[model samples]
Structures are given as structure tokens and as C-alpha cells.
Target: MLFERVESEGLAHYSYIVGDGNEALVIDPRRDCDVYPKMASKEGMRITGVLETHRNEDYVIGSVELSARTGAEIFHADGHLNYRYGEAVEDGMRWKVGRLEVEAISTPGHTLGSMSYLLRDSGGEPWIVFTGDALFAGDLGRVDFMGMDRAEEMAGLLYDSIFDRLLPLGDGVIACPAHGAGSVCAASIADRKWTTLGIERKRNPRLQIESKEEFVEDMAVALEMPPYFKEMERLNLVGAPLLSSLPEPSPLPAREFAIASVEEIVLDTRMELAFGAAAVPGSLSIWLGGVPSFAGWFLPYDKEVLLVDETGDPGEAVRRLRRLGFDSIRGYLAGGMVAWHTAGMESSSIATANVHDLCLRLDRQEKERGWILDVRSGAELQKSGRITGAHQIHLTELPERIGEVPMDRHVYIFCGSGLRAMVAASILKRRGWKDLTVILGGLAGWSSAKCPVVK
Candidate 1:
């Protein structure tokens, strides 16, 4: 049997291609799914099946697109909401790919119709289990997606699915999950690549709880769901348009880019320092690495996006945005910010301050009228110490909670390492808030400088 795991970087999503003899099956594919077919071709196998564990909430699934490209049959769990594409697969349903047998196991917890696929060897011994969002390396899928009213019910169902259906499949089965560490699907997934049922059963903190009631209670905690999730859910259910159907982002000269920025969303995918130094006026600063995780929070589905990357290549940014269901990319600045400067186009820059500057400013906060805005997550604030008198709003929740940030003060934003702080600054900039400054190195620099923090 042949197996390959493809990891989509910014989203930290995982898709797999499993083959035996001359046929292969792809599970939980990402929207840009050419990797699967290319891998299959290299292995001298034809992709005959595409499977989804559940309706994805983060990135657009590539099931329909892959099926169109490879002539593969698409399969997903049955009895959930009606999916517009793919055949509805029921529990215990089995299919043959080459000489390998793949069976779908009903494990509805993350969502009502979540399924886990068990792949058996030629001798009928279970070798690997595609747990989808049901299980991860160090954590289980969040059970709150079904809404707060049914969170407990979903958690209870997840407990039963893990303790009964999954663990009983035996400890040795290699467990493959749909997401990894950076994904929003799980709060604290392990960074490691490979894990087994035995490893997770032994080391997973949540799995250590024996009582179902306790597990249910523990898993019912609410997490901030991204606004784009609703759009992703809708698109994934009805199926997304193929990549070929979408318009490719072209390179536009600085003069043309300036005109486009007025009508389209301007996204600058450069580092925090570069963005802080100088950027296209009114462009949103997300940094190329942050596009997949945070772009959905700020970008609207209706508007076209014009990108400005430092390398002058918006291909990566476009891919990341498309993965999160942002398909209306108009184009990118041809020569990036340098070209804009050469064209004598107007530019904007956000001020930067260090941790020491923050400390001295805090000493004179009453006279300076400066405010510190912490954009880190609540979990990070709890794990690490927090700055006293700083207003706390998670970066993901900034859009809805923007009012809480005082408009009269000189707002100094800081995140874990300043990447998110820059993004937050851009959000504020777009909202017409002036006197913004990003604290360089953020809390890490504060600690390194022996600054005090409140627990």
C-alpha cells in the first residue's frame, strides 16, 4: 500500500492520498488539490475516490473540484444537511481502491454527520484510520460548532464517539486527522506530524478524563468562530466553483493599482517591519503568513482584493485567500511597494515603539493619554502574563469589538510577536483611527527586557 500526507501550510490542514496496486483515494482535500493528482500520477496510480469526513468550516473542500479533474467518485457521510454534491455514504459502507478496503464509520460529534474512515490491509487488518475532525494528535475536534444551545449535547456525543467507536478499533491503528496545530478546528493540536490511536489514547490530555459528564463539560467551552465560517459552511455544502472557473490574479502597474485600490480591498502581504516602514495608503496589513488564518476575519466576500507583496509575487497570497473562500482577487501590484514609491504614489506608515518605550509611556499614561491594546487570544493571555491597564480584545474578535477600543487615545497595539499587532493596526487604520503605533517584539520583548507583568 502507498500513503502520502499533504499539509497545507498557513491553514495547517492535512489531506491524504492512499493507494494500493493502481488505484488511490484522497481524503479531506483542500481547494487547491492538484497535489493529490500529481502524487497519484507519480505513484503510477489513478485516483478513483474522493472522501470528506464532514462539512469543513475553515477552508473550502476540494471534493467536487477533484472529482471533476480526476473522474473520481466523491463520498461523504449521510444524514446531515443535504449536500449538493457527492454520494451520501452511510455507516459501515465500504469501497475498494486498488487492493485496499476503505470503510466509513459514523462518528458524529464535531458535526452531526462526521465520519471516520478505516483503511484495512490486503489481509483485512486495520492499518490506518482517517479520523477527520473527530480526533487530532493532542486534542479532539471542538464540539461547539453546532451552536451554544447544543454544545453540551455535541460534546456528549463526541465523548461517546471517542470512548466507544474510535478507541475500540485498537490502539495500534495509525490515526490521521484533517487538521494540525495552527488550524482553528482545534484549540491545542500537537505540532507533530504523525500519531496513532495508541499514542493519543495514552498522552492526550482530554482523553485522560474517564467520566463522560466531565468530558462533556470540559469540551463545551465556547470558542470564537470566524465570521467566514458561515460562508465556508454554505459553500462547502453546495460545492465551490472549480479553480479554472475563478479569475486568476494578474500583475498590475502601480498607476492601475492605485485606481483599483479605491474600488477594491487592498491587502499588503509583507512583514510587520516592512509594512510599518511604508505601505500602500489604506492597504490592510496581514503579512503573507497570516492571510490564511486572519484574512477571513476582515475581508468581505463581495469585494475584489488587490494584493501588494514584498516579493511582487501574489501567488501565495492568492492561494491562501482562495483556500479560505476568497475568490474575487482582481490583481496584485506589479512591482510591490517599491514600484508604488517610484511612481510617486502616496503611501502610509504606522509608527513603531519598543517594549521600553511602552513601559516609560505607561509611567506617564495619565499625562500622555496613551492606551495599550492587547490583541492576543484569551488563552494566550491566561497562559502568559498580561500588561496591567491594557484593553484586551482578541485579534479574531476585533471586527465586532472595535467600539471597545477608545478612539481618543494614542492606541499602542501589541500581540505575541507584533505580526498580529500590525494586522490590528491596519484594521484600525482602515476604520479611520489615527495615532496608531505597534509595539515592536510585543510581550516577548517586554519579558526579555525584565518588564513586570500581571498574572
Candidate 2:
């Protein structure tokens, strides 16, 4: 048996290609799925089937594109909405590819129709279970996406699916999840590449809770849902467009870029710190690493994207955005930020403040009444007290709720760390709001300084 894990870093998504003899099967593929075919070809295997554990909510699914290329049959769990593409898979249904055996188990917690695929060895012994979003290495999937009213019900379903359906398969089975650390799907997932069911069952926090009611209640806790999730769910149900090739972006000179049409958005893919120092006016600063998860929240799906990265590779940034269905990237800044500066293009910057500075401002009551913009999630704030008089607006919602931020007052933005704070500042600066400052260490820094916090 042959198995390979394909990871999409920014999204923290994992897909698998398992094969034996001559046939291969792809599980939970991303939109830019050409790598699977290339890998299969190098191994002298023909792609035969595609399996989706559930309809994804983060990145676009690549099943349609893969099936188009390889004539592979797409199989997904049958429940909830009727997916326009892919055949509905029921519980206990099995598929065979040479000596490799695949069996689907109904596990509806992450989604109403979630399925966990059990891959058995030639001997018919269960080897590994692809748990999808139902279970992760260290954390379980969030149940909030389905809706607040159904949160408890979904959590209960997930608990049963994990405790009754998945764990009973035995401890030795390797547990391969759809996502890992850095993904929005789970809050406390471990950074490890993959883990076994035995390890997760023993060490995972959610698994340790014995009572189903407690597990359901624990899962109902506050969680931040990214704004783009709704769009992804919609596109996944109807089937996402197949990308024959990745979108190629051209490099445009700074002078030409300066007067270029306003239709295109200038995406600064530089590090948050560098972006905070200086960036083109009205440009959105979402570093290359965050393009997949954050760009979709603020960037329009129709407009062309023009990348501005001085440090990271533009090719990679484009690919990450494309994976999330941002296909109309026209090109990148020809000379990057340095060229923009050399050309004397107008640039904007946000000031950074440490916890000490924040305290001083609070002491002095800084003119116009400074407003603290806490961009962290509600759950984080509840766990760790927030600054007094801070208004909470998650970073993902900043674009639509930008007006809620007071323009007359000095705005100090912050998250668990300074990264999200800088992102918030960039959005405000782009919208022509000035007098912005980012609290260097966010709430963590504030506590480190021994500053008083309001719970």
C-alpha cells in the first residue's frame, strides 16, 4: 500500500492519496489539485476515485477538477443539502482500489452529513481513519458553523461520532484529520503533522470528557467564525469551478501601477511588521501566510487582485489566494514596495505602542478619548480580560464593520499578539481613517506589563 499526505500550508488543510497496485484514491483535495495527478503519475498509478468526508467550509474542494482530469468517481456523505456534484455515500458503504479497501462511516458533528473513511489493509484490518473535521490531533471541530441554535445538538452528535463510531475501531488506527494547526476549523489543534487515534484518544481534551452533555456544552463555547465560510459552503454545494491552470500574475512597473485602474485591489503580502512601517495608500496588508484565510473576508470575489510583496514570493501568494477561489489576480507590483517608495508614491503607516505607552495614554486620557479596538475573538477576551473601554470587533469583521470604529478618537488595535492588530490598522488606513496605533503585545503584552484588565 502507498500513501502520501498533501498539505496546503496557509489553510492548514491536508489531503491524502492512497493507492495499491495500479489504482489511486484522493481524499479531501484542495482546488489546485494538479500535484495529486503528478504524484500518482510518478508512482505509476492511475487515479480512480475521490472521497470527500464532508462539504468543506474553508477552502474550495478540488473533487470536481480531479474527477474531470482522471475520470474518478466522487463520493461524499449524503445528508442536508443535495450536492450538485459527487455521488451520495451512505454509512458502511465500501470501495476497493486493488488491495486497498475504503469504508465510509457516518460521523455527523462537524457537518450534518460528515463521513469518516476507514482505510483497511489488504488483510481487512482497519489501518487509519480519515476523521475529516470531526476530529483533529488535539482538538475537535467547532460546532458553531451549523448555527447557534443547533450548536449543542451538533456537538452531541460529534461526541457520539467520536466516542462511539470512531474510537471503537481500536486504538492503533492512525487518525488523519482534514486540517491541522493554524486552520480556522479548530482552535487548539496540535502542530504535529498527523497523530494516531490511540494518542488522540488518550491526550485530546475533548476526548477525555466522559459526559456527552459536558462535551456538548464545552463545544458550545464562543468561537469566531470567519466571514468567508458562508461563501465557501455555498460554492462547495453547487460545485466550484475547475481551474485548468493556476492564475498567472504579471509584474507592473510602480509608475504604471500608481495610475492603474482602481478596480484592482493592492494586496501587500509583506510581513505585518514591515507593512505597519509603510505601505501603499488604501492597500490591504494580508501577509502571504494569511492570504487564504483572511483575504476572502475583505477582498471581493470579482475584482482582480494586484499583489505587493517585497519579501515573500509572489508566485506562492497567488497560488494560496487561488486555492481559496481568488482567481482573478491580474499580477503583482513590478518592483514591489521598494519600487513604490522610489517612485515617490504616497504611502501610509500606523504607529505601534507598547503596554507602557498604552498605560500612559489611559493615564492622560489622550485627547479625543482614545478607543481600544480589541480584534481578538470573544472567547479569548473572556479567558483573558481585555483593556478597559475596548470595543471588540473580530479582525474578520473589520471590513464590513469598519464604520463602527470611531474616527474622531485615537484607535489602538490589538489581538492576542500584534499581527491581527496590524491587519486591523491596515484596513482602517486604507479606508482613509488615521490616528491609528497598534498595541504591540495585545492583551498578552498588557498582562506582562502588570496592567489592570477588565474581565
State which candidate has the highest TM-score.
1
lDDT of 2 by residue, 165-239 (tens): 999999999999999897888888898787998999899988888798888888986576766777788778888
- All candidates' TM-scores? 0.96, 0.87
Model-by-model lDDT, in order? 0.89, 0.84
Backbone clashes in model 2, listed as residue pairs: none
For candidate 1, write residues 1-455 as lDDT tens digits. Answer: 67999999888999999998899999999889889889989989999999889989999999999999999999976456888998988999998977789999989889988999999998899989999999999999998898889999999989888989999999999999999998888889998789999999999999999799999989998877889999999899899999999988989999999998999999999999999999888889998888888898899999999998989777888888989889999999998888899999989999998887787767655566477899998888888888876888998888889999889978999888889999999999989998999988756556422236877
Location of the lowest summed lDDT over 10 successive residues in candidate 2: 442-451
lDDT of 1: 0.89
Residue 137 error, candidate 2, Å = 2.2
Best by the lDDT measure: 1
